[model samples]
Every structure is written in structure tokens, then in C-alpha cells.
Target: MWANLALSPLHVAAGTSVGNGALLGLTRLVSLKLAELRITDGDCAGIAALTRLTELDLRNSRVGDAGVQGLSRLTSLQCLDLTWTQASSPPALSSLTKLNMDNCKVGGEVALRVLRSTRFPKLHAVHMSMVQVDETGRELLNAICSDSASTLDSFMLPSASISTVRFIGRAVALRSLDLTGVKITDSSWGTLAMLVSLQELELRGTNASNEVIKSLQDLVQLQRLSLRQTRINDGALPLLQSLQGGLTSLDLSDNDIQGEPALQQAWGNLQLLESLQLLKTKVTDAGAHSLKQLGASLRELHIGSTDLSNACFLRACEKLQILHLDGCRKLTAPVFQSGVRHLQELQALTVSDCPFISKAAVLEVQKDLPLRYMSCDDEVLFSAKKTEPIWKSGAALTDRLQELAPYDERCRYSTDELLSARYSEFVPQLESSGPLAAVLRELELVSTQ
Candidate 1:
């Protein structure tokens, strides 16, 4: 039965008896992925016989304590993904090379014990999000990294309340590190700069300032760096410019970086830069032109929420592939006709919220370019055809009731009359405004309803 087993989603749900019948006829089963199944303690008996299984993914399944106990028998298992399951005491996963338990109920001593006890000789990547990994946990992880040598490469511990900075100097072999939503002091940044082998680093939602940017200059091997929602400003640009020769992708999105001088000084040296995102930044047409200077190697560019005209985007039309100009209400048709027509590789173009762009301009671009995807008014618009309906007929009545729920005191009419009203006080205003304006109108109407 084991030799004839064909792993599928249907086979796992039919019960372990059916799986055991299939496993009995199999000789070599390398991978077994039971993702999003309702497997219970009884199903563990079927997995115990899969000694030759190398990869196993039991993510989003009801694998309780008994199910984990059964997993201990499979000594040949290399990769295990038990993400989002309810198991406080995880079974010893010594043979696993990659383990993922992100957003699980496991916490405190039990979480640290799993990391401490698991003797994974080949373990490289570990994803343990929403776990309580404090100072002592960092110490244990440091020991693991020091012992693993070159094997440990990727570590994602986002939402793991890591207040102290203890494991920075120890994890030298780490290539990709995601420290999003972690609380780290200035000293932590200095310690992290010492890890010379780091390639990809994400400090999104962290309190890292411009001072830490100088320390990051030492990480010459870093290729992709995301500083979204950080306190970095113009002062940090020079330090980033130092890594121009090696760095390829840079994200400064959601930062309060004002003016064009910092961008010009930093990006001027980045001859190999391909992807750059300035989403929600205060960059204007001047800043957009400064970025266009790096057009030789630039492929993907996002300058969302800025007051940029289509002319600013036309500057780098040749190499641009994915361009997001969302929330740029000032963009006109002339910017597209003159510049965007040259971009042969342009696949995805977003022109959301720019009411100035006439329907004729959109049709012209669609006719001239090879754009596979385009979005306007949150609806797909391409090839001079509108495929889907934007709003349902009875949606207006339902929306009016929801809007009036918060401020029923202000309305003189009854709930039944408001629901049945052909022309409610909110309906006319919602129809006139755009999507974002409509949402704001509803909030205002609720207060007066």
C-alpha cells in the first residue's frame, strides 16, 4: 500500500486508515504536505510509518500534542511547517533543516525549550512569529547560530517581543533577517552592523534612526534593504550611497524624507540599482527627476501619493516595467503620450485616483503599448473594454443603512423609511464623490444622521 500512495489533499482528509492503506504499498515517499487539513491525534498513526519522508507541511491543521508525538518517529524528516496550529509543547524536531511555527499559541518557556532541545544539525531557516522571544531566548538562539556555522541563513522573528540586543554578533552566517515590529535601541543597530554576511535586511516599523544608517555602511554585502516607517532622513542617504556598487533594491517607503538633494546624492552613486520604492514620501516632480537619473539600471519604480505629473514618469520610460502612480491626482494625459509609450517592458501600470486622466488617454496608451494589466477606480480598465460591474443596484440602500447606524439620533425618519427612501440625504453625496471621498462622506453623514 505504501509504494502505491499518491499524496494529495483528498487522501489526507479521508482518514489515516485510507492513508495507511496507501503508505503500506509505497517504498519511497520523499515529500508529504498536509496543509490546511483537520487531522487529529488518530491521524498520527498514519504518519509514523513514513520514515523516508523528507519534507512535511502541517500548517493550519488541528495537530495537537498527540500528533506532534507521532512526528518524533520520522527521523528522516528535513523540513517541517506547523504554522498556526495549537500545540503548546512541540515534539522534538531534531532532524528538521527548516521549521516554521509562526502565529501559533506556543509561548514562554515552552517556545524557548523547543529551540534549545531541537538538535537540528542542518537547520537553516526558522520562522517563529508572534512568539515571546526575550533576552534569554536570544541567548539560546545565539548559541544555535554559533553552533550551526554556515547552515543558518534566514531568521524571521517578527512580532517576537525581542527588547534586548543579545544575538547580533553571534549570527554571522544569517543572510536574510526580518526584524519588523521589534523594539531595538541604538546599541542594537551597532551590533547588527558587525554581521558582514547579511544580504537582505528589513527594519520596517522599527525605531532605527539616521545614526544607525552610518553603521549599515559596513554591511557591504547587503543587496535588499527596507526602511519603511523608520526615522531615517536626508542624513542617512550618504551612508546608503556608500553601498551603491553592491546594493540592488532599496525601499524608503512611508518615511518622512523631504526634498530631492538627499535622493540625488544617494542614488547618483547606485549604478546597479534596479528597484526603488518611495511610497507615501514627500517627493515631488524634482525628486522624481532625480530618480530618473538612475534609469540605466532601474526597472521597477513606485512613487505613490506624491504630487507627480505624468511628465516626471516619462523621464525613465525605457527600462520601467511595473510603475505605480497611485494617488497622484495631478497627473495629466500629456505625460503618458510623450514618455510612457517608449516603455516596451511595461506590464503593470496603476493610475488610481488621477481624475485628470481622460478615458481617451487610457485608450491611447492601451492601443500603443503592450500593457497586460491596468487599474483605475479600483476596477480593471484595458483594451477599451469594461468587463465587470463596479457597484450592484441594491448596494446603495444597504450602504445607507450602515452609514445611519452610528448616528440614528440625528435622523428624523425611522429605520424602515431610511432603508426604503429613494433619495436619502447620504445617497446623493456618495454618488457625487469618488471612492475615498465617499468613505469620508459616510463618516461625516453618520455624525449628522
Candidate 2:
């Protein structure tokens, strides 16, 4: 019987090869990911036998034309990534849906073969960047652009030209766009305004200006927006507010988002927001206070490198599960003691580069450790080291409880928290003893009832 298997996101070493005999039992593979490495011709020929392959990623590798040519027989292949490879000729694949050949040597001849609408009608997304194409290639590129604009729902190309954007700007069906890597200095930045159907947009580290920001206000369907490392300023508040009702997550990190007015102006109305990132901004105490309006809707916050005071945690909404306080110079241990206690839902916390917070200080504040993961004082920490050993076997835990002359309040509190969180509360199959274990059994029975 053939097993359902998929080996993915695999980084191969240089000169990685596998003979057909070596893969004796693996008559076929579900997927082969040989990205950023060199595979021999023998390996390429051997890989051609994998007719069952559905996904293949060959990004940034030394895969030659012969290696990619062998994949033509893989009729079931759905997604193919040939980014930054030397493969020039890609055979017409009938089942391929997505093709990423960014920074490849595909010229006019290859474009005519792959981009032609007559051959691979199933192709939906065509991602290409920095491809040197001849005059014939340019003509075929226009045809592909026209075809992709009318039918394709997703088109992503960081190296896409201005003309390509103009063509796809008419794509009313496009939903997800990752043009963050595109450096648009002209009206091309404004072209995104036409994509009203877009549900996700990432413009991180791009040259988009205030005018370009205004252009995106019409994208009401957007649920996720990333404007990190951009020239975001107070002028974009109205635009943000326009999308506030629909946005669930937004990243405004690494920008010149100074003062509280910028946040207060637009963020107070974003009650539906579940996650927000403002790392490396100059947000003040009042700016953070605006987040309190979100209440329980806010779940994750990244407020690193801000000038906020100790009250930052108190104002960051109490229901946060993930919090990052790295590079927070103004905050001290008292913030954790006072504000973090209210954050019972917090599972992950990072306080790296904090001048005052030490590992010892965090441990001293803890009675029953609740954090599943924590990073502080340049050391990585996990809750398993402190609590998981006890949870491994409930019988052993019952023995430890019996030895106790008096039950420590901390022990009781932490155990209750673990039970409530349901991460490590019981081992039902294993038998437990002792009076404490009996009490736990009764508690579990009652809780279940």
C-alpha cells in the first residue's frame, strides 16, 4: 500500500543526489523540495520517476534545464517554484496552477511556451521578477498579462514592471497581493486603489507615500494589512480608520509613527482588530492607552522599541496571548508584577534587551509558572523545564504531594492554572495515589460532571 507522504520545506545541501535505487521503496514521492542546492543529473533523472508529485520547490538552486525538463511527465503537479534557477525551458504542464520563476533566465522562447494561454490553461498565478526578455518575450508578456488580469485571482511578482501592474490593475477578482518588495516611485503606487477585491495587502519596506496610502482606502474587503518599514505618518490615520471596521490584523512597525494622536485618531474605532504590531515606533503612553479600547478583541501585541512607561502593559488589553517587550528601556520589573498579572491568557512573553528585567526577577515574581514560553536576559526559556517534568506522570506527582508536610500556596495556584489552561492537567490512563491525588480525582470527576 502506498503511504500518503509529503516531504516539504526541505533544504538540501550542495551536490545532493539520490539514485533511483537508493529510493527503492519510494516508487514515487508526493513532493520534492530541493531549494538552494545543487542536484546532479542522475538525481534529476531519478526525480522524473516521481509521477505522483504534486508540489515541487526548486528556488535558488543550481537546477539545469534537463532537471526541470524531466518534470513534464508529472501531470499531477499543481505548484512549481523555479525561482532563481538556471532552468530556461519549462515544458507545458497541464496540471500546474502556480508558477514562480522570479530571477530566472527565461527568455522570449520560454515565455512563449509557458505564458501562452493555449498550452497551460490551468495556470492561475505567474510570478516573475528580473527576467531579461527579448522583443518577442515582451510581446508574449503583454498577452500573459492580459490573460492573467481577466481570470487569475492571485498574481504576485515583486519584480513586476509598472506596465504589468497597469495590466493587472483591471483584475477585479484579485484578492491577495504581496507587492511590498516593489519599489514604486510613480503613479504605479496609486494603481493598487483599483484592486477593491483585495483581502490581504503587504506593502512593507516600499517607497509608498501618503498619496499612495490614500489610494488604498477603497480596499474595504482587506482583513490583513502590513505597512511595516514604510513612510507611514499621522496623515494615514483617516485611511486606516476607513479600513478599521474590517481589518483583523495590521502591522505598522519600523515607521515614523510618532505621538499618541496618530493612534488615538484611528485605532479607537477598531474594535474588531485581534492583532496589532507597532514595533520600533515612537508611541507614547497616551498612544498605548488607545489600545485599551479594543478590550478582549486584542489578542497579540508587538510594542517593542517604544517610549512608553510602565503603564504600557496595563494599557495593552488584558486578554493578550503573545507580547513582545524587547528594547523597552523605560519599563521595569514592576510592570510585569502589576500589569502582566492581569494577562492570564499570556502564553508567550519576550523581554529581551530590557535593562532592568532579569531572569531571576521574573522567577521571583512567579508562584505558579503560567508562561509556556519566555525569553529574557538573553536566554531562551520554556515552561516544560519547570512544570512539564511533574506533569509527565500523575502518579509521581501524587507521591511528591504526599511528601509535603504542608501544601505550598504556589504549588496549588500553578496546578490550578495548568488545569484551567488544559495544557497539562491529567494523565487519565496512568493510575494515581495519595490523598492529594484522590482530591484531584474528585475534582476532575466533578469538573467533568
TM per prediction: 0.74, 0.69
- On a 0 to 1 TM-score scale, where does candidate 2 land against the true structure? 0.69
Off by over 4 Å in 2: 1-61, 65-77, 88-90, 102-109, 112-120, 124-145, 149-154, 159-164, 262-269, 312-316, 385-449
User: Per-residue alpha-carbon lDDT of model 1 for 1-449, expressed as tens digits?
Assistant: 53666543222432343345545444367677665667666776777777777777676678876687677888888777777677654457667678776665554465466666665556788776665655555655565566565677887766636765456566678898877767785376777776788898878778888887776777878888888778887566666777623778888878876546755464645667787777777767776766666778877776665566746545564787766665667777787557778787876666656677765676578766777666555455552222321233223433333322222222424444543432222232221212223443444432111
Worst 10 residues of 1 by lDDT: 425-434
| Model 2 error, position 230 (Å) | 1.0
* Candidates in order: C-alpha RMSD to true structure: 12.5, 13.2
Error of model 2, residue 103, in angstroms:
4.7
lDDT of 1 at 34: 66
lDDT of 2 by residue, 267-287 (tens): 544577887777788877766
Alpha-carbon lDDT of model 2 = 0.61
